[model samples]
Target: MLSLQQLSKQYKNSELALDNVSFDVPSGQVIGLIGPSGAGKSTLIRCINRLIEPTHGAIYLDDVELTQLSTSKLRKQRRRIGMIFQEYALVERLSVMENVLSGTLGYVSFWQSFFRKFPEPLLQKAFGYLERVGLLEHANKRADQLSGGQKQRVGIARALAQEPSLLLIDEPTASLDPKTSRQIMRLIKEICKERNLPAIINIHDVVLAQTYVDRIIGLKAGKIVFDGSPSALNASVLTTIYGKEEWNTTPACEEEVSIAPVPNFQTKLELAI
Candidate 1:
């Protein structure tokens, strides 16, 4: 449903954040992007939504070239793309319902939204999204009153309130505990499945990505290093993506450990055959 072709980004300081990164996202598929720090995962997500302008290449959503759109046109196109940030990015003083309703800002008139006079159907949809994310009871509470996980849930509901065709999730679990991270990941995957909405999740944790995503793409130094099913991401591929030392020395019990088996003595002997 989405296609990125030869996308490249060069910052003002001559730093290339992304380099000719091209990929396609099929409808209803969950694709995970895993890479080390500064690997352009976040940049790629931002580029998809045009939050950061790309230096070159085209992005197409169902044949509409997002990169070529004018400001007004882009605003209309943006309504179909939802973004979830590393930080929850909620309006602290606003109620949970209000924060979720903000997703419809692009669809409403400035004066209407300014007065908090959204249509009843839109309000009902916002409430439905809140309930879907398990935050219906907290609708009237201020965003600042929620826990980290709950805040992220509010973020999810707000994004879904846009009724987006595709979701761009940037480090969705970066700030949460392990258990909460898993819960959030599961929730995103479940919601995407139920709604058949495609998503590209930029995740720092490779294990979590493997556990949740249908496919995985590995980026290194702003370039595509690997792209395949999660099970195909073995140690060798990981080493190629993140360097051998980082992959090898990772503790066995660490959640980010490579899924491939370590070359122990017995395993080495078996390989000799």
Candidate 2:
């Protein structure tokens, strides 16, 4: 439902963050974006959301050229695209309910939102989303009072409150511990399947991405190196994407060794043709 054509981004000094990157995300599909640090994975997402302006190229969402839309129009379009940040991005002073309802601010009238006067149905929806994220009991708690994982759950609930058609998650588990990270990832995967919301998540953990997403897109130096089903992901592709011959040299994390082989791991690499 989203397409990027020759999408390129260059800073004023002409440092390219993305280079002629192009891809399409089909509706109801969960696509994982993976790459090494500075591979432009984060930059790609920011460009898609127009959180950072693209230096050149076009982004089309269901036939509408996002790069060409007026500011006001773009703001409206943004409501259909929900973003979840790695940092949780919760307003520390706000109640969980307020934070969840903040997702609807793009739709609520400026004055009404400023006054914290969301519609009753919207409030009900917020409560429902809290329950979906298993945070219903924390509805009245201040966001600052919650743990990192709980805060991220609130973040997810906030995004759901938007009732978005597409979800953009940036390293959703980066800050949480291993167990909590897995829990959050599982919840996101389940929600995407149940809601049928097309999603694009930028992640550093290849194992998590492979386990959770329908498709994987590997990036390198601001360009796409691989894009296919998770089962198709192999060591060679990862080596090229990360630009590391010794990419798989590290010993397995206790966690990594337990489950299925991570395609990027040394043992898995040695086994691959």
Which tens-of-lDDT digit does each residue in 114-209 have in candidate 1? 999999999999999999999899999999999999999999998998989999999899899878988999999999999999999998777677
Q: Please give, for residues 12-41, the per-residue lDDT of candidate 2 as tens digits.
A: 885788999988888889999988888888
TM-scores for every candidate against the unseen true structure: 0.91, 0.92
Please report, as a residue range, the 10-residue window in candidate 2 with the lowest summed lDDT: 264-273
Candidate 2 residues lying further than 4 Å off, grouped into runs, are 247-257, 261-273
- Each model's backbone clash number: 0, 0
Clashes of 2: 0
Number of the top lDDT candidate: 1
Which pairs clash inside model 2?
none
